[model samples]
Target: MEKVKVDLVVTGYVFNDKKEFLLIYHNKLNKWLPVGGHMEQNETPDEALLREVSEETGLSVEILGKSEIGMGGNVKTNLATPFHVNVHNVGDHDHCSLFYVCKAKGSGEIKLQEEEVGGFKWVKKEDLNQEFIPKDVRNIALKAFETVE
Candidate 1:
């Protein structure tokens, strides 16, 4: 059997004040996806998602999750638990993605990273069923809405 390469990545479902979630048209994937990207060295999943959200949308986001576990001598910090985790193939490789639910913080504009994304949209529950949206993405997006509700 051939070995498959998998990379760690983070994805965030960023919601605005109006209960709309942000979706960006990924240049490489050529599909609409949540704001996220590959994790950098020594960065936690939450940090990666936060950075990706800011870079993709130019908006500060408050990731929603909690870890009641107490910190110890070896534990520098407790990371927020991801709302969902999945390992999906991306043709040439696979991505072990940690999905975080986040809400937009303060005021900001939706400035997309032109080179990384082709376009972006703020979608509501009704919009998730669009033909262009992948099933997993649609399911996860719906879960995100149910989570905040």
Candidate 2:
């Protein structure tokens, strides 16, 4: 087996009130994928998820799931849990991705990250079969769709 470098990454399956999923055309990967990237050091999965969504889609998102943990007196932090986790190959490396469901905060225009993303779209679940999307991505997207619906 070929040696593979593994890295932790966070992904968000952002859905609007209409239940359409957000997808982006990654320039380097040449495939339509969810909004996500490598996790930065010292950042929790929830933090990374939110950051990636905003950076790639230019939309502030509200992650779905329980955001609060009551450990004791006056200590609380809101953070979402990953709906799914998977390891996928990306060229010479693999990413252990944490997937979370999310919703857009407002009606904001998408601003693609020109360097990494080539295009973006809010697609219906049925549209996952489009040629531009990879099989694995489509599977993950389908699950995310079912999750929110």
Report the number of the highest-lDDT candidate.
Answer: 1
Measured by C-alpha RMSD in angstroms, how accurate is candidate 2?
A: 2.2
Top-TM-score structure, candidate number: 1
TM-score of 2: 0.89
Q: Clashes in model 2: which pairs?
A: 67-78
Put down candidate 1 lDDT per residue, 1-149, tens digits, no spaces.
99899999999998988899988999988998999999999888888988888888889988888688888788887787888899999999999999988999988588888999899888889888898888899999988898787
- Assess every candidate by TM-score: 0.94, 0.89
Locate the minimum summed-lDDT window of 10 residues in model 1: 71-80
